[model samples]
Target: MHGKTLTFLLLLISIACLDLLLTHCGRSDHKQKLQKQDTVLLTKHWESPIPHQEIPEGLTSISAASCGTCHAEIYKEWQQSTHAVAFQDPQFQAELKKDNIITCLNCHTPLQNQQEFIVRGFINGDYKTPWKEVNPHFDKSLQLESITCATCHVRDGQVIGALGSDRAPHKTLKDPGFLSEKLCLGCHNVVDEASPQLVCTFETGDEWNANWAKREGKNCISCHMPSTERPLFPGMSKRAGHFHHFPASGIPKFKDREAGRLESMEFTESPVHPGYSPGDLLNYQLKIKNSFAGHNVPTGDPERFFLIRYQWMDASGNILKEEVHRIGEEWQWHPVAKKISDNNLKPKEERVYPFTQLLDRAGTYRFRVEVTKHRMTEENARYNQILGEYPLSIEVYSKQYEIAVE
Candidate 1:
């Protein structure tokens, strides 16, 4: 009986050993399959004229100045653009330091990989914290040239664009996607779940897609990066080429140009009397037609807003009575709702503001209407210390009508 029991124990031990060996071999096979898959992906990423090229030796790490050597004209236009100063912009830097939210840097100074930059978070819908370490392979000297030439053109040693076959020192891939809205949407249509409400901080891409731009097949490049007849490369003949300026709503220098795009304010006064007396009520109507902006007037940043302020002023320019009508999204934080109100003028949208003021005193009174653009609201300014300190509020449009009060 003892001998039989000992044989059974040995058999059980042998079975356990066989199971362990099989599991080990299975794991090894699985690991090998994963490694093979990764190798294929890497090969596809580095598919250029020069095979087996290391990332350190690739154009991805090259500075924009290197490209300027061949394409001087295009480079010059890009140098003066907002994209050139995106990371170094005073307002952006101030907000970054004040908020201490390092995640903002992801979009400001994006990764070399366009796909990785676009898909910032994880597949599980979780927000992945960006890597704190600067890439050793990147050109440190060109780090501040935010949204640099490499951001859009260079990808794994290949230059991607919408241009035709051209002989360059490096490999070129003519990607039509560069001409489409897809190129801009990657960074512009971000939806952040970190906020109490899922906030679309930059909604230009979404707005363009949903508005007349999409229906009319008008891409972002059509308006923001309009084509100009000029020589792109040193040896190339003059051709229709798009500029890299990427003009949008916020830049102060472009305020006049943007204002000019709006249809002139249509004013209509009720009780068509030539003169007014004390305690008399007068109604004034103003219509602002958004004829130019393919999207909303203040499109990109959520904090951006516009106000149409109507004031009744005396000959001394003292404001006697005033009323402000906002024409942009109004929001508040803490006990956060999606949006407090959104009166922003949409594409081809017309907004009307009617003002009625009672004559307080009999004298020469001037009725003035001014359109002002604000970087952010007072509540947002309070939260963002830098914004409050360097607030960007400018009058974009203004008009006045003098009425003699009897």
Candidate 2:
């Protein structure tokens, strides 16, 4: 009788375990279904149409301006970044001289009709003259600010925010780190695999998403769009909890030349008087490497500048001659008070250029190049002082040149 009871009890316990397993499986399926429904709903909303608008005259495209319609403050701040000026940068224009295509505009500059933007030379194309209607240009609107809202937050074709998110915007964080940091990698970690040749030399997002940067706990927005004080606006009662500036790598030479950051420098020599007599031709080479940087070298606004000063001097320490080799030119956003250029060599990159000039007078001469770092703002200028001068560096490159009197 006891044995019979033990068998009956075992059967009852087994049945209970089976019932529990079935319940757990059912809940798992329900959760997955909810997730799928959420994804589908998001897609439907993001794909919803905005009234078609005409492409601005001579302009190839125009984004929906969805974020601009709501978050005017963020839209304005976004305009201040280099991402906004991705296309209009003169350096970018110089690059276009190498490879011109519409594919680049599609990613670099957001527009409604990329073809039109290219045709207008508002992007990369055969733009011989300044664009008449530069709306598609970064200087004109805040719409093209580095991919903006429509690119990522509305993933799976779903709006993710109160403004442009495809779904009914969820104000509260359902996922603990969702709004704080996690969702950033979904887009910022992107790379242009379609044309690896034209790939951005400095892919900060790519670097930040890597295991190294991840281990450091550096989130995307922390470095890309850093926080700055701003007046709180409506519709952002929740988002305002964490300021979203999306600080980027690279910055212009700060206004205070002494405050510039020094990474590295280089030098080279070219035929100064290849076939000419002593008073005929003076030639040499100038190279300054962006050996290092606190962030990416060309950080912040697209118009940042880096330049080098070349001087030819006599033994008496008197200035015999001098020329400036601009690594980069004065950008439009911050026009140079003087003619200045930048090498724009990213970290670990090197550039070489030959300098030639006819010598009017011959003397015991020496060549000297000083690297000056300039920033757009005074409080921010450090490219020169931080990198070159602060410690009174004696490692500068110098060479002696002579114009042999015939």
Candidate 3:
């Protein structure tokens, strides 16, 4: 009887060792392939949620309300943020209907319990090899929370972040890495497998790395997560903390800011050129600078753009002449997805527009400049069928010159 029991125990130990060996070998092989930049294989890797065996103790419910128990202020801010409704955005929903929509959920609603598929491999890529199955552990309620706090703060069944509280309701651990730009790359960095020139997804992180990182020591946290002097928790005393209402292109005012600023607008020869009279030339230079933004003025979604409108208006505010300039990346959307041109303002770069027109009449008029931020192109807007779902454009800068037409 003792020999039979020993044999069974040895057999169990052998299986456990074999499983660990296989898992380690698989991970090593995966790393090697990624170094080769096999995009299809990489796409196969990201088509699933972050792996974890169980929900964190304090986040089992996967509700923002649960975090609100101690983080009331932070929770309110998250409610107003784009991340809170990422999975539920109507435009995104419509766009995802045509293809393998489940792949998108890995980022939009990125929690193990939020997905219905336990993807083993692609039905078609490197990540889709073995096969997929229904996830018996899926929780429908968790799926609706979208990119909730747990998406970043919960991992391996613990509450993790740049700072963690021991007095809180859950097990906490401090991970300084949570504050790094790499954390944002979990979703923000994406390159196209088909067209490498035009990364078809948000390459905000990559842009920051290439254009802004080396020049400036700031990262996404410096902008998106500004410091607040709110208590880490009640009774902890006021101190610097982070929240979710990112001052990026998420809100109307932020859109105006990140889109760039109209530094100044003046005539080339101010004072209207000495002895300027009718039949003479009227000239001026309108200046625009990407003052504060770290990346291109209108980065992120390719659809985002800026419109600069230069106008000559009569005293009655009736426009007599207008010239519009577009600043954004243009793309060939059909036949093949490719970028045609990109004239977005670069970091600290200033563009000057010189205007000259014959002064044909002697009258009082106004030379005006208006800069507006457009969220997307009209064609794409109509296709998504979300023309009026929200404010599509916001006026960023407007200046009028009370001028006398010589």
Candidate 4:
């Protein structure tokens, strides 16, 4: 009798858990689930806005300025960061809609308070497809804050960070995940083997040379958010924290002079050849390297590209012959994104671009070579209505030579 009772109790407990899971699955909002197999649903990820929850205690509001009350320096750095204006960026705003979907907001405005809707859960346990609903708890002010302190460091009303501090006004908890690359994975790195994703972040983290970067003891944190000894906040004792600015390709000079470096230029002319005509063939080689970046030189967004130009001209700098090469990926996104070609430099990789020119009637000729980073093409700029903004193209490297022939 006693054994039968125990067995009955265990069976009942299992049934209860199964029922709870089913009910929970049914309640998810992003991908509406139905009992009928005929029903179809849309998909999403890059994680829905963090569901509505208790804000970290002891902070006045969800505004980053509220955190700035204590973490002054970090807050100020964040103000200058691209994350601070993720949603309000003019170019991003212009490119937000396609097929009438605004799903990109998940990464841009990530906190429930910042989002217009909340994802209760995903249907059929498919996180790729979330079940979303109107969020009664939405705060428009937080939307303007974009990716903020709460988005990364707050959960269940506790402050999550790399180090726990007894001195903090609120409960401080240390999460080792903060120190690893996983922290940036959702937005930067993404689902596995899922190509042609409806929304593409352009695979910045996926392109990273993990084996090489790891051998060097570097990662997203070490490269993008190098740590320093500083007070967690102003009055606290010095400890390890990282820069919040999160700089990368957004800063043109940062990539140009540092990561994508122009290493060397080699030139040769065939002047001593027997029976050589009046034309002196000029042979040139230029080396551009993606030495410092752990990922591809231009990793994110198809709009990002490098333009290499070679020109031979009279001493007056009037162009005579010019050749141009574009280094980047091309894609066709009409039906679904399919990469056509990729010539972007990979980690620690160097590419040599060579060209030849013939000089027949040259007294003194100028040879010029240049590499420029183009953040956006003018055609796309006009289509996106950001043409009035300053040209995004920035010169990374250039060289000039005066070749004299008698």
Best by TM-score: 3
In candidate 2, which residue ranges exceed 4 Å CA deviation? 1-66, 90-100, 110-146, 161-214, 228-232, 235-406
List per-prediction Cα lDDT, in the order shown.
0.62, 0.42, 0.67, 0.67
Question: What is the lDDT, from 0 to 100, of the residue 379 in candidate 4?
Answer: 80
Distance from true location, Cα of 292 in model 4, Å: 0.9
What clash count goes with each model? Answer: 0, 56, 7, 6
Q: Alpha carbon lDDT of residue 362, candidate 2?
A: 48
Evaluate residue 29 in candidate 2 and report its C-alpha lDDT on the 0 to 100 scale: 70
User: Whole-model lDDT for model 4 versus the true structure?
Assistant: 0.67
> Candidate 1: lDDT over CA atoms?
0.62
What is the per-residue lDDT of model 4 for residues 126-160, given as tens digits with 9 covering 90 to 100? Answer: 43333456678888888888888888888887888
Query: Per-candidate TM vs. native?
Result: 0.73, 0.37, 0.78, 0.77
What are the per-residue Cα lDDT tens digits for candidate 2 across 28-113? 57554533432222121111222123433322333435455555676655555445555654444545554443344444544332
Point out the higher-scoring one by lDDT: 2 or 3: 3
**Which digits, one per residue and each the tens of the lDDT, describe model 1 over residues 64-132?**
777788778778777767677677766677666544444455566664432112221221222222212
lDDT of 3 by residue, 216-251 (tens): 787777777777777867787776687676556643
